[model samples]
Target: MTSEETEEVVETTTDSSTGAARITAAPYMPGKTFTNMFEKYATDGLPDVFDISFFGNISGSTIAQIRSTMRYFDLIDDQYVPTDLMKELVGTDEETRKGLLKMMVEEKYPDALGLSQNATSGQLAKVFNERGLTGATVDKAISFYLHMLDYLSIPYSSHFKKRRPSSNGGARRRAAKKAAEPTPPPVHTPVKPKVSTEEEQKAAYVQTLLDLAKKDGADADLQDRIFDRIEKALGIGGGPAAPTTTGGGTTDSP
Candidate 1:
């Protein structure tokens, strides 16, 4: 959890859970912005020194998603250098690209590839659910698979084809219920002085959310529903009433 009044920043992936240090797993998240970078790499050329500078003005979170997607697809080496797979993706013919993607789907996401074209979103989720995924965590993996299939012109369950609007249906109901039930007065929270670097603080905030999302995924949703809970809990107001879900946030992609 991030403190609105806090001034100190804790560096690195320290475990605040149960006092034991946690070993990490290979990163494999994909987010909405990942495709943008993957596409940009094909056009802009992945610089030899791959780092923040490689993606221009995008946020650090965006870069993290992009890197995670690359790693997930085995497109980049541990050092962030483009692998032969990625180079081939960038330069291959359309048919070869399809073959390469199919190979990846078979090897890395056999569960996703096995799904029937008419499967429902709930069924799609069940595939990940059985693997212990939940929330934006599941969204990341699914987003990557979906985008890859889209790029390959592969058929998938039409259930997952719809975007974020109708899903906001739940959001609207929650917003209304919250509006009708609110009565407590706001508790005035004391302000604390800033003592951390702006960028570092931003990174810390994002890392906290990412860490939380990851833990559950290891059972996830990203924006809208997930963020709505975060916003209400934080009492950060978008307006007098909750705002309707709008726009896309992040999704897993490569």
Candidate 2:
């Protein structure tokens, strides 16, 4: 062990019951996985080696977990040969199965179980940690243990019974959903409003005057003034010059 790992080990406290655990690591796989393996194998009879040939289509890692779980419960010997306990634990008689299951818990996890008939998940985890389990292994181990407890009708406080998770579910769901969605449309930039220039305003004013002058009610005098205004506005050499005299003599034009 590295000095750091030794230090971590030194930090852990061991209960007498914890020290009694036969296996080094907890079965981090689902308890049901291996329990089912045991029951089905009991139906088919024991294998010569609990290897790929026996387990069939599952991954190597999963086979290792099954082997580890079997070791934890003392269900198999060093050669991975099924012990009599393995067969009896999966037998048809409920009473025999329950007895063996209880005995297995007392042997493997008396530390946490002895703490309380109803210890919370946190309490159980602390016991596992003290037994040198760490990282993601800790939670997974706790899950398997909890499943065993439930299977034997053992009640615990402070944990809602958790369903076994679908493998890598959240990430798989997010990836699938992302692939299925269509790409978003490109953002639309709004067109800026066109501002009228001062020259444009002036031209518009001149045009309005011209249009009014063309109206029927406009007398020639009014039309002339309007045209003068238009000429001045357009800078057509017309300025605010003196008013011209009209046929009306002294013109009323100011």
Task: Compute each candidate's TM-score over C-alphas.
Answer: 0.48, 0.54
> How well is each residue in 1-254 modelled by candidate 1, as lDDT tens digits?
22211211211233687774322222234534454454666777867745666768966665665665566677776677888888887776657767876777666656666778877777776676555555555555566668777876778878886533224256778999999996999899999976655444434444555566556443324534545444543457452322222235323210
Tell me the lDDT of model 1 at 154: 73
Model 1 TM:
0.48
Best by lDDT: 2
Error of 2 at 78 (Å): 1.3
| Candidate 1 wrong stretches, greater than 4 Å | 1-39, 162-254
Most TM-score-accurate candidate? 2
lDDT value, residue 209 of candidate 1: 53
**Residue 233 miss distance in model 2 (angstroms):** 53
Candidate 2: tens digits of C-alpha lDDT, residues 6-93: 1111122444776732434566788787556656766777776665577688776776777766766777776678778776776556
